[model samples]
Target chain A: MIDPALGSLGAQIVLAASSDENHPPENIIDGNTETFWMSTGMFPQEFIIRFAESMKIALVTMHCYNVKTLKIEKSISDDATDFEAISEKEFEHTEGHLQTNDIPLNGTTATHLRFIVTSGYDHFVSVHRVSVE
Target chain B: MVKLRSRCLLVGDAAVGKSALSQMFRSDGAHFQKNYSMTAGVELVVKSVNIPETSDSVELYIFDSAGRETFVEACEKLWGQPSVLCLVFDVSSELSFSSCGRWLERVRAHCQGLHIPGVLVGNKSDLSSRREVETSVAQEWAQSQGLQYHETSAKEMENCEAPFLSLAQLFHALYQDRLQTIQNLA
Candidate 1:
């Protein structure tokens, strides 16, 4: 098991629809649950994480809140585009506590993973931490 | 352009209208989000406030943090030594007002003995009929804590700018005072 999202691993957040100086996309992989990246206000917010090298990922654990529908995609190309659908899940509504869930990819080989929050239970969604293995 | 920057922390209990007031100030009263979404983590917004009689302005980087206790530890990591504090509470909820002490203590502890200027904001002032925290009571508490007090109604868009403006002015004053001290040494 390995945390490919760590900065030491060279995981980079290539693109984020909304950017807040204090709460940037870097928080998603910072291994801290207290810090998070929040959407400005809109549906269909997406972010792409590029790994240092292609690896077979079996599971992706995410700690988030207000996320209703999450779609995961993967890409092996050098560029950020051309991602293929890997897994999608509808998260259960939670309050007061965080919504922690894991997505199984079944040993899929890819260098990049994209997470799209298509909808949220509230106007804003927060992604606390993401880790892959 | 003689611009200054400061990190303002907005912290309080859950559902106390911090987000609404911040959004209203950020949008200049052009936008007010009515949807109630509890902040699970910190939401940052930046705005520039121009001093009335001077060409200088202050850029406020507001850290609107989650109010829930479950996320406080994680939230504190994001709040890196705030320059000012905007502690908010609901006027209609006594429990919310009471929690201000704990919130203040948390922020104070995180500051590590730094003198951070701040304010106590009684939000949801439009709900005067259901008010649980009296103005005098809030004011006394604020005075005891060395923080200015203000009341606002984010729903009605009344006096939403006072708290932030006061903070900016206070920060600018501090900057001016420090500059004078340095000049005195020279």
Candidate 2:
């Protein structure tokens, strides 16, 4: 899912998508691949970590191929894991007015995956989809 | 013997004609001309539509949420309630159409582990000349996102009822399938 920030507003949007309905296997991911489309911006590292815990599998598409590839430092990948480590961390970093809850990790089979796609400036990665096997 | 009520949510960016379309459908020609001040938190309206085949009326509880970013939290409350979601956008606005991906992602993230049925709606089809989002582009995106897409005009009331009716049919079919499964188990 596309999260613009790590604040309550961003978290709220992510929560909304998770609660909708069960579309079915066919819709979840076409064939065997699920595409997650996202835009490039400053995403809260903690938020990404928390998102990984809930998802069985996540494929992040970096907006720009070249730039994103260059920016692919060890820190970004480390941050991905950092966010998933503690839900409270995400809650603490969010904007003041927004309220956040510790969403328990149900320990589902969903694997968290990442892919950076080109949106321009190879540094930007836009996730296209997430497929469940 | 008893009627079942299902809830539905209408979500999208501002000026997408969500409220206007809903008013037309719910009121049936009774015009309420007040800038309803953008659905602040979450506003709900209930209406019962009769199912012709079976003398039953399925009550529909619709939740309309504000499109502004500030109200995102309020919108989250309605997630994962076993309801059909209509993602509305303005046909004349490319930015609105492009934002669908983000909105869809938000819904998926919030309703974790739930596969919600979604319909992509492009409003303001009455102004054909000023259209910014092409029908083909919308259709392509809907296909990629696995959503049913329809272009409608609440102002003219053209095809306004179609989306709601189609969603009702989908819900009924799903309900019947579940009932059959239960009977088989019995």
Candidate 3:
């Protein structure tokens, strides 16, 4: 059986706004919802995920907690720059459980994806898992 | 740049200069309050220490608890699993120095045997004429407990920064080790 999660396809988080000892950026691509990358504090936290090669991504799923507003951008070049806005969503508040949302990417081809949390419902937020289909 | 934050619990008997030492380090040895009304509750002092030879830094949130036993019982609830410890005592008072064992025991019990690296600080070193605790004895005890020992005079702002700096560095070292472990897991 083949897993559809991009994490299983060797996606890696190359840049994160905050790198906490306990909750690291690596956790975002660990393919386990139980493990998560937590923001230390403040707003406008962002992370960039790099793929082995540019692939057609139609849908993106996220399991997050306490995140209010999120924006996504995609870059096809070798560098992480020259990105274009793909999708934006205002997540509902969740307590005791993760707020899971599936975002449509319209099958865009990209080598890197940037997820930015513009704000949070609380002082801190956690991104449990990011998968693409 | 691999920034980290840690909680440092400052504890000892009352009037042992825990506040003075933290204040001195926070202000870079600038202010030493001459007349201090004993801290009645838990006082929090935050300081940022840059680790040597690295761009990484550790933001130390120092919880300076009241020395009196009654307040300590209440302060214990606020500690919230301290990452490091700073056990202080007055070198001029043997009784205060003796209380070090009790404080250590209490912290050990509270942490449930978790190994939190720390330092043993002998404050009030300026009172050499009235000193009751010897450096050799304190050094031996600290070694037995696996803690680094340092003597400081908070009154004169002498060596007041060493213990806190050591604690920050110790925490930073721990973070580095953990970072390596996480990276290897990838």
TM-score of each model, paired residue for residue:
0.59, 0.55, 0.65
Proportion of native contacts kept per candidate: 0.00, 0.00, 0.11
B108 Cα displacement, candidate 1 (Å): 1.1
Comparing candidate 2 with candidate 3, which one achieves the higher lDDT? 3
Residue range A1-133, candidate 3, lDDT tens digits: 2324446677778899887767888878878877778765445789999997888888898988878899999999988889999899999986557889999999999999999998776545778788888
TM-score of 2: 0.55
For residue A79, what is the lDDT in candidate 2? 31
Candidate 2 falls in which docking quality class? incorrect
**Candidate topping DockQ:** 3
Q: Please provide, for model 1 over A1-133, each residue's C-alpha lDDT reduced to its tens digit, 9 standing for 90 to 100.
A: 6698886779999998765455688989988877777664445789999999988998999998778899999999989778999888999987667889989899999989999998776545678889998
lDDT score at residue B121, model 2, on the 0-100 scale: 93
Error of 2 at B87 (Å): 0.7
Clashing pairs in 3: none
Winner of 1 and 3 under DockQ: 3
Instruction: State in Å the error of residue B42, model 3.
Output: 0.6
